[model samples]
Structures are given as C-alpha cells and as structure tokens.
Target chain A: MSPHLLTLAEAAALIAARKLSPVELLEDCLARIAAVQPRLDAFIRMNVAEAEEAAREAEAEITRHGPRSPLHGIPVGLKDIIDLKGHPTTCHSKQRLDHMAEADAAVVARLRAAGAVFPGKLATHEFAIGGPAFDLPFPPARNPWNRAHHPGGSSSGSGAAVAARMVPAALGTDTGGSVRHPASHCGIVGLKPTYELVPRAGVFPLAFSLDHVGPLTRTVRDAALMLNVMADGGQDYTRGLTDGLRGLRIGYVRHFHEKDQPASAEMAAALDEAARLLAAEGAIVMDVTLPSLDEFSAVNRTILAAESSVVHEEWLKTRPQDYAAVTRRRLLPGLFLPAVDYMHAARRRTQLLARVNEVFADVDLLLTASSMDEAALIDDEPEVERTYPRQARTPFNVTGQPAITLMSGLSSKGLPLSLQLAAPAHAEALLLRAAHGYERAAPWKDYAPPC
Target chain B: MTDEEIAALVKAAGLEDTAARYPADVRAALAQLARHKGQLPRSSDPTLEPTPAYVAPRP
Candidate 1:
C-alpha cells in the first residue's frame, strides 16, 4: 500500500520496523497532495522545504537509533491559524498575508519534540470564522468526496486532507463545532478534546472560553495516537481502544436532532441505525434529553460573537472591507451585542454545564447527530447557512466537554453521514473508547471519501 | 432594529461602509442577536441547577 494511504498508527508501526522510511512517506504524501490539491484546495501554504529536511533527519535518527514515538517522522498538517515558527499563519485571510511567526505554537513545539514532520499549513476559515469564501486570500477547500461540495469548516482543509489521504493527521481548532463539522462532513474522525486539555497559548483566539485544539484523523485509533503527544502528560488514550461499548450506558441525545432542529430524514435514520448497532454490541442505549438546541445555540452564539468581536473589533472598525462578506456578516452582530447579554450567556454556560453534568451521572456517553445533513455544493451559500447551525456539537463546546464525530453511514447522494459521541469533561479516554467501539461495528467505519 | 438604528450603530463602530454595502446582513445579524437575547434565562429564574452530587467549575 502507498505509505500515504496508511493510518498514522500503521505508518508509525512500519516506520518503527525500518520497513517504511519517513522520507518515503513524506514524499508520497507530498505527491498525493500535489495531485489532489487542485480540486480540493486543502492547503493554504506548502512548507515543503522544511518538511523534507525534517523527514530526512527523522529517517537518519530512527535508522541510527530507534523511533522516538508513534508520531516519529509522521507528516502532520498544521491548521493555518497555528503559529509554525517563521511561517505565515494566513488564516486564509488577506489581513495576515505578510505576518510571520517568530516562534512555534505550544502544540507545534510538542509535535516537534515528538519528531513529527510538517508538510504545510492546512486551510481554515478566514480567521477560523468565515470560510468557503470567495474573497479570502485563498479559495475555500472542497469536499474530497465530491470536489464541488463543501468540505466543512473552518477546519475545511484539515478534514479534506485527511480524507483524501494527503496526510495521515492534522490539527484543528474548535470553537463552535469547526472541528466536528469538518469531521462529520468529511467522513473521518474529529475529536475536540476537553477545553484546555490541549493548551491554546499560540492558537488564534476565536471565542476565548470556547476555543479548543484537537486532532482530525482517518480513524479513531489514529486520533488516540495524536492526543498522546498533543496534550501534556496525557493518558494512554489507546489503552482502552479495544474496550468496546459492552455494558456501557450510552445516552441517545435524539431530541437534539429529532425535535430541536429536525435533522434530514437520512441523517436521522443513520443516527438511529448507529444506536441500534451499538446496542447490539451490548451498549445500553436510552433516550436522554438536555436543554433545547436553541438554548445552547443562544449561549454559544452570544459568547462566540462577544468574544470573537473583541479579537476582530479593531479590524471591523478600521478594515471592514478587508474581511470576506460572510465574515463581516458573522462578526458585525457582536459589535452591537449588549455586554449584559454576553455576561448572561456566560452565566447560562455555567448553568448548562451543571445540567449536562447531571445527565452524565447516569450515562457514560452521549450520542447525537452531527451536521444534520450531507455536504452541500460549495457555491450554495443558502444551503450552507441553513445546515450550518443544525448540529449537536455546539452544546459540548458550551459545556466544555469532550466530543467526537465519526462516519455513521453515507447519504443517497454519496455524501458522508455522521453521529456525534460526547463524554464528560476530561473524559477523553472514555470518549475515544466509545468512538473506537462504534467505529469497529459501524458499517461505514472503514469508509473513506472516494477521492 | 430599524435601518436607521443599524446604520447609526454601524457608523458608531466605524463600519459605515458595511452598513452601506451589506444592509441585509446587518439587519439579519441584529435579528439573530435579538432572538438570542430572548432565549437567555432571566436573572430572576433559576439559572444554575447543579445536582447535589457535585458541581465542578466550568471546564
């Protein structure tokens, strides 16, 4: 198999056994990226020179000594919003076209220590907010499954790259389901670690309290391999990968899709089949209701608008024309949002977390619908706007819990369908366990976008 | 919000160009903001309902 097609874990194993060279894997990924990038538009900037040098060094070191870790020599893509020492973190925007980073983001530093290679900066929404936009410095990424469809964002490039087999792993930030959205729409695994689990010292801030850094990979096991290095003093997230969902109580958050927003009939059926599959494996599936999606939507949007406004206020005031029309439309409301409402949203966040905690006391995991529909045409702005908020991922962001979305099935349109899995705060291990278990039994678990 | 109120707010935020260029978007944003404010729990109502088990600080 082409090294580029290997999951991160499989590539790591081969690399450790001296059968696959880091240089070979990196070059293979680069070649595939060159081939697919024209259609997918998944990368903002290609830092090929440095990545090649690092891959060569990793190969020599591993040959002379031994592998440093599973990620040793693995070529991982960095989201454009991250500061990768000396690279322009364009954030797919014109505002930072000339901005250069003097130091690596903390996560980049950790990955460097783990000996991971970087191929380039992946595409993100403009400042991780506005995306698939025509006015940005670069074009929006398209879904690998269908080049004309949206790939999901603002981690659009990350998801597309992984699904297209251009790279094995990529990092993405989640504020309001950016990570999970792409994961869902891209037919891959997107894990938004608990808030603060992965430090955010160098990541561009969207919503201060809601921002989180996590990994997007092709499989749940690859995601585990990713978190082992991304977070500090992490647990053996892979230790429980084989611990299936037997006897585990999974609370089906049907209301989030069934009543709150009414997911598409296909997506709703996919989620139901996923729950049934898990129950067949001995998972105790039962209905669990939280507050309405609108309630969480209000709290999430209020905090996101107010906090993001603080980051873009000066620009909104002085350089409004520089922003994409979509970005401007999204950020302008924050300028008019009453400060009292922002605070009220924060207070409401606290209340929501308390309520979710009460629910967790009775269940080990929460399952819900993600994306609510399949990928839409990239140019269909109205459809994007309509399906964007019909997700269950934002509630976890508001509550600061760990959540992941993975492929549940496919739509009749040949687009990927997904279901979300969430756990209590700091319960990433359990979240991974349940996701891995579900993926193993899922009919679409091994499904990749036929790129 | 009235068009005049939105234009005035846009002008105050130094985004008069935005109001002129994307009036509908500005109006849409204002409408969504109003809807969000309505969904927020009233301060008088019970806001934080922590179960007796334990109430950890917000993650």
Candidate 2:
C-alpha cells in the first residue's frame, strides 16, 4: 500500500514500526504529486532537490532513533501564507510573489523540529481572501471529489491536497471559516485552534485579530497529533479528554440550521443522526440560542474589512491593479470605516464574547453545520458571494475560541457534510476530545472523495 | 447613504477607482453599517469595557 494513501496516524505507526522508510514515503508522495498535481493544481511551489535531501536526513534519523515524533517522517503541505526559511511566502498573490522570508514561522519551525517533511507550498486563495481565481500566478485548486465543484477557500489547496491523499496532513489558516469551510466541503477534518494558540508571527496577515492557524487532516486522531506539534506552550491538548464523549455537554445551535438558512435534507438528517449517536454515547444534547447572528456578521465584517484594509493599504495604494478584482473590490470598503466604527466593532465583539461565555457556562461545546449548503458546482454561480453566509464562522473568531469541523456525512449528491464543534477560549483539548469522540462513533473520518 | 453621498464617501475613502463597478454591493454593506449607527451605545459607556477575552497577556 502507498504510504501517501495512509491516514496520518497510520503512516506514523508504520514509520514507528520501521515498516516505512522516509525516503520511500517521500518518493511515493513526489510521484503522486507528479501524477495528480497537474489535474488538481493543489501545490504552488515545490523544490524536488530540497524535499529529497530532507527525506534522506529523516531516513537517517529514523534509522538511528526509530522516529522523532508522530510526524517524524510525515510529509505535510504548508499553505503559502506561512513563511519557510529562505522561501517565498507568496500568499498566492502577485503583489507579494517576490516576498521571501529569512526564517520559518513559529509553527513551521516547530513542525520542522518535529521532523515533518515539506514537499512544497500549497495553493491558497489570493492573500487568503479573494480566490478560487485564475488570474493569479497559479491556477486555483480543483475539487478532488468532483473537479467541477468549488473546493472552498482560502485554504482551498490544503483541503484538496489532503482529500486527494496527496499528503496525509496539511497546515491551514482560518479567518472567518477558511479552513473549516474547505474541510467541510472536501470531506476532511479541519481544526482551528483558539486565536493566538498557534503563534502567527511568520504568517501573512489577513486580519491580525481574526486569523487563526490550524491543521487539516483525514481524521480526528490525525488532527490531534498534528495539533500536539503545532500548539504553542500556552495550549496543553494532551489531557486525554478525547477518549470518550460520555457525560459531556454538547450544545446544538439549531437556529443556525433551522432558521438562518435551511440545510439540505441529507445534512439535516446527518445532524439529527449525529446528535442521536452522541446522545446514545451518553452525551447531553440540547438546543441553545446565540446572540443575534446578523449583528455578529456585521461586527465581524467590519473588523475583517477594517483590519485587512489596514494590512493591505500600502499595497492597495501602490498597486491596486495587481490584486484580484474580488479582493480589490472587497477590500476597498475597509479603507472607509471610521476609527470609531472599528472600535465599536471591537467593543461589540467583547459583548458577544460575554454572551457566548454565558452559554458555555451551560455546555462544554457548541455545534452547527459548517456550511448550510453542500458544495456548489463551479459553474452554478458566477459570483460566489451569494451562496454563503457572512457569519457561519464569525462567532468563534469573534470570541477567540477554538473550533473544528468533522466530516459528519455526505450529501445525497455525495458531497460532504461537516458538523462544526466550537469550544470555549483556549479549550482546544476539550474541543478535540469531543470531536474525536463523535468521529469514533460516526466513523466518517476514513472517508475520502472519489477524485 | 444615498448614491451621491456614498459616491462622496467612496472618493474620500480612495475607492473611486472601483466605485461604479460594485456600487450596489458596497452601498448595501455601507447601508448595513448605517443601520448600526444609532443602535450601539457609546464606547465610553461603562458597559463597554474591554473583557479579559480580548486581552492578550504580556508575554
């Protein structure tokens, strides 16, 4: 069996048992990328020589000490926004295509220390916002499930790569649902750790206050393993709460599904079945109300627009023509927000966080459909903005809490359905535990798209 | 904001470049913001103090 086709945990076990060679695994991955990348376009940049050299070093390490960690010989794809020492952190934008980094981002440094092999930089939406575009330096990634559907963005390539089994795991960033949305659509597990839980020092900033770094993998256990390495000192995710969901309080934001925007029948059925299964496993499930989602959307948009505008102001001013039309058009509004409005948005976020805290006082986690609708066909809509909601993920970003999306079931059309689990501030351990428990019961973790 | 008023805001915001191309979407978003104008209380209000949630402790 190809090591590239194994789940991250499976590959780690094989490496630990000396059944897999890091060099062999790297060759398999490079070969698979050679065969599949032309069609999927998931990778943006790759250096065969460097990856081969790293593989040789990793093989030597495994020979001497068995393995460094679970990721000792694992090959993982990094989103382009993350800085790798001596590599360009292009951010999938022409404006920053020439920007090179002198050092790895903190998380990248940690992953390298853990002995993770990097094949190359993965594709991302333009600057992690305006994308799934063709006008950029690289082509947008195609959905592995059906090359015709949107793979979701801006971690578009990361989701597609993992789903296609090009790599067992990949790093992704989420700001307003980028990672989880793609994971949900692509039939993979995506975890967005609590804000600042993973240091963002070397990442290209979209919205400083809202951007979160996370992992996308094939299973909850794999995600857990990845998180163990990515987590900073402040986050302790090894408390072993993930073994069981027994006696955990899982809150369902039914209104998010029942009222805001109705989900497909298959999705609704999956939610009910998932809730029942969790309940069958001794977890408490009940309905919960959130503060007005509309207001939440408003505040999140204001903050994202205002902050991203600030980040790109100089570039926008100097070379507005270089940006994708969507970003230039979407980002232009941020420059208009008054200082008072930005402050008010921040203050409203504080209020919303308090309300969420009150809700968490009753439950350990909150659940919602990652996306109310299934993946839309690529040509179904010319303008993608109309198909999605503005606040599906804004609440968690607003609260600075950790959240994850688990592959719950498939739509009638075979597209994936994801159940989103959000935990309290800095409670990623509990979040992972709950997600892991649900995953074990549902067994959707092993699902892969038929690309 | 009215079309004329919004255009002025766009010009002042240095978005006159793409203003006509996406006027409705931009105006709609601004109009959405306009609705929040009188709803939120003043930032100086005692109820609006920063919570420990947004505070990142000095590392």
Candidate 3:
C-alpha cells in the first residue's frame, strides 16, 4: 500500500479508521528517512527511539482515546531554525549548535498539544540565508526530485524531506519565499500562513519583519489541516471553508510571469491551463497590475538584509568567519545601512502595501508563478546575489501576507513548475480554499521524483 | 569603500575578529558595495515607523 508515501490527510483517515497504527506509520517514515538521509542529507539529527516511544503512546491513545486531531499520530519534521524544547535549534550554524531551547517555540508547543510526533530537526541554510554553500558544518540538503538539483533555501531540508516522502509534512519559515521557492523546486505544497497568524516566539528570527512559519505538505488539504492547528488562537481559521471556488474572485498576476519574468514554455502553458480550470470552476480570473517589480525586490532586500543583520549581529561580530561567504557578503551591507535607508524602505513598504490591498478590493486572491523560473541543476552556480534575483516571493514578504505554492505543471526536464497564491493578510483560509479547488480540478498532488 | 575601508569598518564594528579573510577581489567587491552605500539618499527623518509594521499589520 506504500504506507510510507501516504499524504498526511490519507494517513490520518486510515489511522482514524483503525486501518493503520501510528507505530506502523512512524516506523515506515523512519525507515524511509534512514534510506534517504545519506543521499539527501535532509535531517540534522534523528531521535528514532523518542519517535518510536511517542508512536507507541499514540497507538495506545487511539485505542483508548481515539484521535486527538488530524496530526494526532502524524510524524512531522521541523526546520532547524524553530525551537523545540531540549533539542538544539541550530539554524544550521555551528556557533548556535550547542544552544538548546528550554521550551518549544509557540508553534512547536501547539503541534505537540495537537498530538504530532517529532522525528527530528531537519537541515537549513545557515541561519536560513547563507546556503547552497558548502562551508557549513552540515551539508546542504539535496532536492528529492533530482539529487543533483538545488532544493532551494533557507528552508532547504524541510522541502527536500517532505517532497521525498520521508515525512508527510514539515514546518518551514518563509522570509522572501523560503518556503514556496523550495516547494516549487521540490514539487510539494508549501503554505506561508498569513504573517503573524502563527506566532514566531522561540523560533530564531532571520528578519523579524519578514519571517513567517508555515507548513509544507504533499496536499493542499494537509496544508490546510496543519494550518488549522498551527494558527494562533487569536487568528482566524479557514478549515470550515470547503466552498469549492464558485463565485470566488481570483486575480492572475499573469503580468508577473507573462510580461515580466517570461516563464518557461511549460510554466506559461501550466499557468494558462490552471487559469482555465479555475475559470471553469467559477473563479473570476482578472488581470491585476502590481507595483514596480524592481522597486519591490530592492526594498525587500534592504529590509531583509538590515533586519536579518540585527538578528545575527552578535554572531556576525563574534564568529563572522564562521558564516559562509554569501551570508557574510549579503549581510555586510546591513551593518552599514545608516538606519535611515532602512526607514525609507519601511515607509515605502506602506505605499506598496496600500497598493496591494487596493488590488485585493477587486479580487479575493492573487496568482503568479511561484518562482521567476523553473528549477536549476544542482551543480549550476550563478553569482551568489543573482541566485534568486527578482523572486516572485518578495511582494508577499513586503506585504506581510499569506502565500502558497502548488505544483501547476512539469518542466521540459520533468521538474515541476508551481503556481503561487497570495491572500490578504490573515486570509490564509481563503487562499487555501482557492488552492484546494485548483488542486482538485488539476490535482497534481504527489508525483514522486524518480530518485 | 575600498578593501581598506571594509577592513576599517570591520575593525570599527568589532567584527575584525570574525569577518572572513577576504581575497583582493572579494574585498574589492564588498568595498564597491560599501561605497555605493554612500550614494544612497540619507533621510533627514530617521525616526520613521518600523517595517513589517507598516504593511497594515498583516490584518
């Protein structure tokens, strides 16, 4: 039955029906991770014993108490940047390797309370921004779709692990498309819940302003399920929304891809097909214009660089050499940012935010190519700064909104091209519903990489 | 901002202890970026509202 590869939603249903046991599920996932870790290097550490023990308890809980939630017995991976009590939240940096958290980050606590079993922490770009470089103590995670291709970063390992089916879902932080970029490259569903809808406490910050924690899953429903639990109590819940896209307003930022970045042939075709399917399902597809793309990326960079510098200032000063060249060079500018250019960027963000909000007045959601382009070969090296120039993710980051990426089509080389959905702040439920409807109509749920 | 200037900033920032040992070319590039920093407009109003803050507070 390929128990190891079941999506979170499928596995949860089977467990609920007593057709599968958490123990059996956990073992299958552990075995898969064992088989893949050497080639993929997705995990920083594994607590097989702890995971097994938890599974046993979960098995008993199902017998004695029934399921606690969709993830009640589900095994979930966490990016190394999030704090899990008693484990080293290393953020993939040696300087912080020994730093242990005394309590789970708020999201971790919520996941645990909801009955998720933790197998271990996964790898990440050093401190979430310095990666696809080799000088770190741990190797960067390889993409599951093709080991030789990049998995994208800062949430590199989480994307690799989830796409590999080594774990059904994982928690990843998105600051400037960290989650969606990797999901697009690895061919999975990555959801960045509306900014601050999931609390950031105890999670290491890259850019306090841009950093957001969300789920990467094999299915939109799984992401929706995970979002329900991960969302803060004060935040809105979109789980009850199953309206199926009728009469929904969907804005296609086709210009973002068609006229601006020029998506690959496969990507363009996929966008057209996705739009057609959604229109057939009753979504009003309209063309919407965004603010200047260059200005958006530049402002996003300025804010992220400046803020991330503040977060890493201590390490940058104490063990600056410990950082990879990319991180060091990228972060160096923040130190000299004069604090006012940073302010100017912040003020500009206001104007841009208003424009985005105004666009939403005519539409419920915005769509664009998840990435400016498709996946690149693992061995390919571009100039460090040019690696992600003009990412489709900066606008969401700049606006502090929720965004998601779904596999829309396959590239010429057979890699996946993704469609991105961005919803107004705290409107993840609507975004997920729209994504769920598209996913159903064009269901590219889980096409495993021929690893 | 030459390699010398970057070195000076590192030393001034107290990261002289940790900044990577830059080769002539990399140092030159960083120095160029640092100099470009000088070309950025300096805001007379430095106390503007903080960011990720002005984005309508994420609703």
Evaluating just chain A, the predictions reach TM-scores of 0.99, 0.97, 0.96
Q: Candidates sorted by DockQ, descending order? A: 3, 1, 2
Q: TM-scores across all candidates?
A: 0.96, 0.93, 0.93
**Best-fitting candidate, measured by lDDT?**
1
lDDT of 3 by residue, A185-223 (tens): 888999987777889999998888888998999888889
| Chain B, per-candidate TM-score | 0.58, 0.61, 0.38
- Give the TM-score (vs. native) of candidate 3: 0.93
Tell how far residue B34 is off in model 2, in angstroms: 5.8
Candidate 3, residue A432: CA error in Å? Answer: 0.8
lDDT score, candidate 3, position A402: 83
lDDT of each: 0.89, 0.82, 0.81
Q: Interface root-mean-square deviation for each candidate?
A: 5.3, 4.2, 3.8
* Clashing residue pairs, backbone N/CA/C < 3 A, model 2: none
Leading candidate by TM-score: 1
Off by over 4 Å in 2: A234-242, B1-7, B15-47, B52-59
